[model samples]
Target: MSMSDLFVFGPLAEAATFEAVTVRPLDGVPARLPGYALTGAPDADPSLVVREGAVVEGLLVSPLPEAARARLDAYGVALGHETFKAQVDCEGGAPRMAEIGAPKAGASGPDWDVAEWRDGQGARWALMAGEIADHAPPLSPTSFARQKAMIAARASSRLRAAATPAPATLRHEARAGDVALRLDAPLSGEFFKLATMRLSHRRFDGGRAEALPREVLVGVDATLVLPYDPRRDRVLLVEQFRSGPARRGSTNPWSLEPVAGIVDAGETPEQAGLREAREEAGLQLDALIPIFEGYPSPGSSTDHFHCFLALADLPREESWRGGLDEEHEDLRLHAVPFDRAMSLAQTGEIDVIPMLAMMYWLAHHRARLRAEAGSDAA
Candidate 1:
């Protein structure tokens, strides 16, 4: 197959993101696409639209390798874009025929800015593009599009993992080449991905260990909020059917737990916590106090929890229902006294680990919180 040029005016125009999608090095020259205007918004890819007398300033990457072209094609298809032949005017040269990916329906939005996107969503997009390339040969582009949401969430998870600081004071400072990944492949599912990997890591004794096979249940970061009414001395708990317990063949699959939801691709953990507080229980939190931030089960899954104690007003109410209809959540909200919640945890009634952890956290800080409730209102 002959290599073709690609005219990029969007996030792909950024050197780092473009490099991630291509296997071979390709030089890009300044180019202009006449009669097409670029438009986009935050958290969305740039789009091209036909506009008379308009010129889109972009980069013309020449001789994109066949494999790289396939990768880009999968990416474009997943984003609802179609590849088309176009005439690109290279700097100081006559117009040349090139391939461009544009929205199938000619979607357009507000003005697009590459610099603004590069500073924010670019890192996650690049990571997502790499994963798209990895799974495209076995998984069709149509199938890949169906899984793009979860893929973006997973990419956001990776981006967070990279930026998070891991203090090495009590642990060994990880160095470059300490862990070498030999193999990584998808194992299952669309909503929640499962993957198997073989990797080798540095041993405690300063020796390199042989690669070991491991299966991981890939999951997005989530927020767990235990809403506490400081003035009323009560906490709000949500009761809902849990699939994990059902899968384990438990007699009672319904669980009593704190409000919880996934940290979306573009949202911060705190933002997710507040949103979940309202979504799961219809409560406007006064304040959110951090309780925990770590993996629930690091050995087997990528489920990290950002637990918090949400201070809110809980008027005395019998069990009431809440939760988003779209999520199929039939949640029953209970306003129980803080002491009673602790008793439930002790009696094995509050079986959810995150809820129990948050209850204990609230117990430890209860006195101070109540004492300051009058002044600490948000």
Candidate 2:
């Protein structure tokens, strides 16, 4: 089989990402796509649009192997892009027909800047490219498309974990090569994934342990907000059905809990918290008070929670329907006095542990918050 050529713009033109997608680092010559301009946000994939006098400069990678081409095709298909042959002006060579991935419909935007993209999003894209490489072989483009969100979330999780500071003052400090891991086949789902891994880690006694198999439910980082109206001495809680309790064979699976949502691929926890508060309860928070950031079930899942106390105005509405229709959420919002909420927590009526924890935190800070509210009124 004869190898072909690919004219790539955007992050795909970069060496690291190109190598990850293609499974090897191959040299490329500079090329230009005439009568076309690149468009999209700085943080998004650049799309090609028709422009009479514009020329899009990019890399022309030749000798694209079969596997590499297949992977590239899968990537483009997953992104809702289509490949078409285009005549590209190659440096020191005549114009040649090269495959280019473009948006189905012509899109328009500012001139493409590879250097600017490198400065802003290169590292994260590189990490995500590696993830794509790992999945491109086993999964079809359609299947990969369905799991793209979770894959991006996993990559974001990796980037965050890498950048976060882990203090080992009380625990054993991990040395180089303290742990080694190899991922197995993952069970992919629409919003989450179950992954199994074989890992070996150094024991507390400083000896390396044998590799053991472990499975974990991989979930995106999320934010949870418990809305409190300090002046009114009340808090808003949302009641909704939860699958975990239902799967656990509980007779009643409807849970009274905080407003929550998953942190998107590029969004911050605070942003997600505010967005969720609006979507789940239609409340614009006056302020967001950080309560805790911890794992809900660290041993068996990657479900990290960023919990917050949202100070908001709670009217006399006893009950109201809320939640985004797009998400298929049928939530009931309840405005309960702080005392009643705490009592529910104490009596185990509020079975959601994280919400209960937040209630306790509110209890500790209630006096100060109310005093502040009183002071502001004066």
Candidate 3:
């Protein structure tokens, strides 16, 4: 253990979050740092400005292990925090205080509450912090912050994945002991990430499989919403140039697909579905229906999708204009009869899997949806 005393003026002050990060009990005592004012982003790290006569209340932890202190320093560095010395009132006198970082300008708030943060975002953040620490190799400061920005979405993905029932293929592995994780390193890219790992698992023949190096693209979870107007017997679809199929040298890069978007930070799949409907097709979803949730390519990707069959009103005039211009989204909307959409799905005119799946689901449940709308109209 290294003899280092520290002052936490933010989320790190919470005992549970502190312990989770440092992997040791935090025997922190309430203390105050004088000559500083408290301010920072809510649910994130905090900052302190040196202000005469201003005092910030925080926790004072001392004599942390060298390793733990080093990890904490890395996290702070990644988060734009710089270390400074301050006087913390502990043991009825001034004690040496190692502050995390320098204060940020342009954005500041009132004193942060450890209790409120722990109550609201603590669970997911704790899990994400640990995971990020585990995979973080010393990256450039810019990369580090960018990676840090993704933790919320990562936490959401993990939580949603946890709530899902294990698939049939995964059931056997679930019944057995946890597969040995030879590696779990995450590599970040511009828009996605790659998790590299090597592992061995029990074989069906009661033998261990050889450890093999593997990599899978770690993707953000997304929402796919297919809009259907039961009263009009029409569905709204959008055509956009898909980069993936284009990269594969497909003759046609434009894909006919449903309204879709990456689940935004702190937003649920249902929220994303509705927002995407409005953004992509100029249609507002009234009520939603979940159709499917699955990994698009589990073998080599972590692209999980929450697919929904959205009930909406699609006006004929709105079919030509859609997609946010700010995102350079050149989307063209098409409003087709339900049968035409189904025929498109059958004839391979629809190239997107989510569109095909939703069309088939609508085919199966069209009668009931129509009847429900009729009753509501009556």
Report, for all candidates in order, the number of backbone clashes: 0, 0, 2
Highest TM-score: give the candidate number.
Answer: 1
What overall lDDT, based on C-alpha atoms, would model 3 receive against the true structure? Answer: 0.74
Error of 2 at 100 (Å): 3.7
TM-score per candidate, chains pooled = 0.90, 0.85, 0.82
Candidate 1 lDDT, 215-334, residue by residue in tens: 888899998988888888889989999899999999999999999999888888899999998888988876688887999889999988989888888879568999999988899999
Query: What lDDT does the true structure give each of the candidates?
Result: 0.81, 0.81, 0.74
**In what order do the candidates fall by lDDT, top score first?**
1, 2, 3
TM-score of 2: 0.85
Candidate 1 ranges beyond 4 A from true positions = 23-26, 92-94, 105-108, 137-148, 374-378
- Candidate 2, pairs of clashing residues: none
Q: Please list the residue runs of candidate 2 whose C-alpha ends up more than 4 Å from where it truly belongs after superposition.
A: 33-35, 50-53, 62-69, 84-98, 105-109, 115-121, 130-151, 375-378
lDDT for residue 363 in candidate 1, whole number 0-100:
79
Q: Score residue 20 of candidate 1 by CA lDDT.
A: 70
